[model samples]
Target: MSEGGIPTIDIEDFPAQMGKLREACEKWGCFRLVNHKIPLTLMSWIEMGVECREIIKVYAKAVHGVGMEIAGKLAESLGIISSSGESEEIFRDWACQFRINKYNFTPETVGLSGVQMHTDSGFLTILQDDENNGGLEVMDNSTGEFLSVEPLPGSLVVNLGDMAAVWSNGRVSNVKHRVQCKKGEVRASIASFVLGPKERVEAPTQLVDSEHPRYMRL
Candidate 1:
């Protein structure tokens, strides 16, 4: 829970938290989420599904679909959605990438990067980071420096991706992050990405009104 700048959002107080969520997205492009409706038991089930390699993708897609609804509501609070309440449905159509990464410690691979620095080239990513192991870091958009993201137990980290930036007409922040294996420990994380439309990605007309002109076409 030692998130230096990123705020922690309580989903139970969704309406109350929308403002904070919007600020987090606009500034940090990522935040720690708590009070999520999902139960710890379900999370354990997802873990089991991963181990069984049977229902991992299905479960990830279901989680991402729910996450997208939350995102759309957040967008609504910011007046960034379409004229009708269709943004959530539209986002559900986006391609999903469900993946789990395993970082195992090796004596020969000391001081190697687990993941290189890069921005998520999608709309959003819901990550279940390792509760014990932490090597994730995100770049500060203003300072041009990287900040370490510590592990928060029983929390999901939501990151706004490239398509989010474009869809929000540049109001949203697209975070850049990388991973390092600081300790000789095995770390595992699962992520679900919501890629943009099958046709083309664009900001909704409501988001590009006079007050907020379109920023990125794609």
Candidate 2:
């Protein structure tokens, strides 16, 4: 874990860092990722024109690949799938939703809440937050208090959502988070959500036993 309560995972350290990634999902429900697949140039292009649907399409495809890879790692870390490459099938066909948000803050909005605290309904979300402004906050699972998430340059934020908890059978954390207005400036972010499976979603047999039963079916 890092000093800020969120863990940092480097994509370059994959398979080897599966333990770290699993810990982040179960403990923090979120983490800061470095050395991800998305290029900084692509991020800049997306930010330059949020209304450009063509650019968004390309970005979504790239992000979807990363999301699936992360999902496979999660499965491997949980012991649900072995290293024989079967983990990739766990969420190979899951859907993705791309979103770009721009917040134009004014004098009246300073020190106010930008987005209310809530948990995402999808399986997971990959976020590229603004590098300049700081307003994101996540609830600390240990202390039950919201902590500010400072901007980390060249890093992406990953948040596990409600469906993650459902799929993990209560093993993973589905945390609450929100955006605030710390300064009267514009803020923009790109979010890619990997929703639950296309078919029904249920906890794997390995995770549902006597001690750890299935929590819900969706």
Candidate 3:
């Protein structure tokens, strides 16, 4: 269920591993997922030329599906629909943003931060990190220490963001992560963000009570 202390969730196991998924969100705030079904070719930059835009289009569309799928599972893990029998549509009309990051690392930049530590602002982030370059790190909420996130081939990393924390009424953790320069190489990553649902986001009535009150509103 974990690789090097980082949670590893196999999406192929789905609802059966719902508890693990929820635990990953609550405890690790992020997880590396396998069997996501995205092709390896699309995970690359596609030569970084004239077809860059076209590749992005294809890649975005594919990652978008995975993003929505994860969003739905997260809601289900929260017992949103099963508890109320009401069709939860927190991801309905959600926005997907695609980003391709390129980091130029050098000897002088080694041991430096490629990006500052911060929590994502959206609901979830599906990241295809560089298979050859490993620099991403996530904080271990329990100890307040950052742990290196080693790249797992053919797997994608999912990070719970601020929106997830708000939607789950503090049940989920908004992870803090950063990218450091580990080597002098060109590091690239593709990320698909599942953002606002175009509707007010709030915890389900079932999650809010005298025992467990809502912690945030969006």
The alpha-carbon lDDT assigned to residue 216 of candidate 1 equals 74
* C-alpha RMSD values across all candidates: 3.0, 2.1, 2.8
Candidate 3 structure lDDT: 0.84
Misplaced by over 4 Å in model 1 are 1-5, 45-51, 54-58, 81-86, 107-111, 209-211
- Runs in model 3 deviating more than 4 A are 1-3, 46-50, 83-88
In candidate 1, position 217 carries an lDDT of 69
| Top-lDDT structure, candidate number | 2
lDDT of 1 by residue, 133-161 (tens): 77888888778787888877777888888
- CA lDDT scores, all candidates in order: 0.76, 0.86, 0.84
Best by TM-score: 2
Q: Model 3, 29-143: lDDT tens per residue? A: 9999898888987776632754577777888899888887787788778887662123335566877788878898988999999999999999999998888888999999888
Give the distance in Å from residue 69's predicted Cα in candidate 1 to where it truly belongs. 2.4
Per-residue CA lDDT of model 2 for 1-218, tens digit only, reads 11354789998896788889888999889998889868877777635775677877887888888888788888889998886268666777887798888999887899899999999999999998998888899998988888888988778899999999999999999989999998898898889999988888889999999999789988
Collision count for each candidate, in order: 0, 0, 0
**By descending TM-score, how would the candidates be arranged?**
2, 3, 1
Ranking by lDDT: 2, 3, 1
* Residue 164, candidate 2: alpha-carbon lDDT: 94
TM-score, one value per model? 0.86, 0.93, 0.92
